[model samples]
Target: MQQYAILTYHQIDLAPPPPAQFRSLYVAPSAFARQMACLKALGYRGVSMRELLPYLRGDRVGKVVGLTFDDGYCNNLERALPVLQKCGFTATCYVMSHLLGKTNVWDIENGVTQAALMSAAQIRQWAQAGMEIGAHTQTHCKLPLMADADAMREISDCKAELGALLGEPVEHFCYPYGLYEARHAAMAQAAGYQSATTTQRGKVVVGTDFFQLRRIPVVRSTFMPQFLLKLLTGYENGKGA
Candidate 1:
């Protein structure tokens, strides 16, 4: 079976000094550049979900890794995009439809640092720059914690809203916090997304569930050797299993 690694990233800027929350979510720009350079050096092409779909469905195959950024951090555009372009890679940035141009309010209670999300124009710039924009939801709410109807609306409406904004269908999704149930997967399918990723640690193999696809995370502390292991071997998949 052909296994593919979909890597997850959150913020691609300098991490705040210690005592800030979710510090692991931040990967410094220089580190990110090195990681991408390493991928290129190894002959792997990092791609967006849109670009990876055919491979996931057994329609095509190659040395490809799906690149994804959660929460639509502005830093992704400011810092990550140029590096991705230089490496000739593309990524999917999952944004909250209703929270564009705002901070991550959903994380306020958890003490996560406030950061700017991409605005509509900035998102257009990303798409125009050959990157992809997927939907996280209308507000980045935890899907399983809400009633089915509310959850369904969050899933379906986000696609519609983002599609309208982009003039193209938003064909991918991600579970906020990786917290979701079976019904939420169905909701994602119902919302017309081709795939939905989670925080699950693993590389995707043939016959993996599209709606609940697994991912390998690249965090602040992940060094070059470990990153290569996660991509080139079954390192992370072993952990998830």
Candidate 2:
């Protein structure tokens, strides 16, 4: 039986930033490089969401994994891209349509500094470099708290805009802040996404819900020992602590 893992990341920076939450989620550039290296060394192949669908249907692949980065931080392009490419890995990057070339306000009210997202051009660069780009909604708003119309608009608009930019169908989505519900999943499906990811920690299996796929969040403290455990043991029992 084939099993799959969805790995998630945010900013890649060295040293802890002022915002404690930032440090908890951010994986430094060097550390990311090491992580990818470890995966490659362990014979893991990074597959895209689209590719994994076939595998989920019992089509076999050798040691397959999926990599996803949420929030579309410029650091993903500046730092993580190189490491991924070095390891011959391709990942899904979910970008907030409204935040392209703009600063994210998610952390502003909390007195924590936010990061700028990649521009449309940078997103195109990643596409050209063989990375799959997915929609992270128009404003990175939490979908579960949104009304039905608002949720529909957010998912539909982002997919339309991204498809126009990429000249390809944008079929994947990630719920902002890892927050999603049954309604959000239904909206994503109606909006034309083939699959969507959530922060709910777990390993993806043949019976997993395509629209509510779970991912393991990789953070600053996610070093070699924990990383190895995550891969070897899976995320069935992880609550992200």
Candidate 3:
């Protein structure tokens, strides 16, 4: 069986700024670099969603890994990109369309605080640097709770805008906050995406659902030992979960 892992990261700052909403979610930039170095040292191959299609269908290969960054934070471009470039790994970034030049407003556990999102120009630069950009929806709204028509509009419109901005089709999506239901998957399909990702923790197996691909969340405390376990074993069986 072909096994694939999708790792998720939020901010890559050394320390979360005072009043930073997701202080707990911040991973130091150097820590991210170390994680990438470990992966490279272990001979893991980074595969994008497009490249993973065959593996998803049961095509076997050496250890395969997928890296995904969510929320379109500017640090993704500032911190994560350089580390990824160093390791020669490519990742998919999910951007919230309405928050393009603004900040995320729905910081539930962290209160109603905000954090900077990437600007259109920054997103374009990342695209030019070979990072895949995907839609996280127009407002980062929870899709499962949205009305069908509203959900469709959020998914489709974001893709259209991103496609226009990048001059290419935005073919993948990540659920906001890893929240979604069957209706959400249907809406993503209606939006013309080839695949969609989720916060569900597990290694993607040969027969895993493409529309609701699982991802392993990487946080500040996940050092080399934890990181290697999560990569080799699924998150459900690893320490993070």
State the displacement of the C-alpha of residue 35, model 1, in Å, after optimal TM-score superposition: 0.5
lDDT measured at residue 78 in model 3 versus the true structure, 0 to 100: 93
| Model 1: worst 10 consecutive residues (lDDT sum) | 232-241
The CA lDDT at 208 in model 3 is 75
Please give the RMSD to the true structure for each candidate, in Å: 1.0, 1.7, 2.3
Candidate 3 — what's its lDDT?
0.82
Tens digit of lDDT per residue, candidate 2, span 1-241? Answer: 4567888888887644564455676788888998888899999877777776777656665687889988888899999888888888889999988889987687777665667789999999988889999999999897888888998899999999999988999999998887878888898999989999988887877766888887887888887999988887854445752
Model 2's TM-score against the true structure: 0.94
* Candidate 1 residue pairs that clash: none
Clashing pairs in 2: none
Whole-model Cα lDDT of every candidate shown, in order: 0.93, 0.84, 0.82
Runs in model 1 deviating more than 4 A are none
Sorted by lDDT, highest first, which candidate order results? 1, 2, 3
By summed lDDT, the worst window of 10 consecutive residues in model 2 runs over 14-23
Among all candidates shown, the one with the greatest TM-score: 1
Between candidates 1 and 2, which one is better according to TM-score?
1
lDDT tens readout by residue for model 1, 1-241: 8989999999999888878899999999999999999999989999999999899999997999999999999999999999999999999999999999999999889888899999999998999999999999899998888999999999999999989999899999999989899999998998789999998899999668999899999999999889988888899985751
Model 3 backbone overlap count: 0
lDDT of 3 by residue, 209-228 (tens): 78888778888778888888
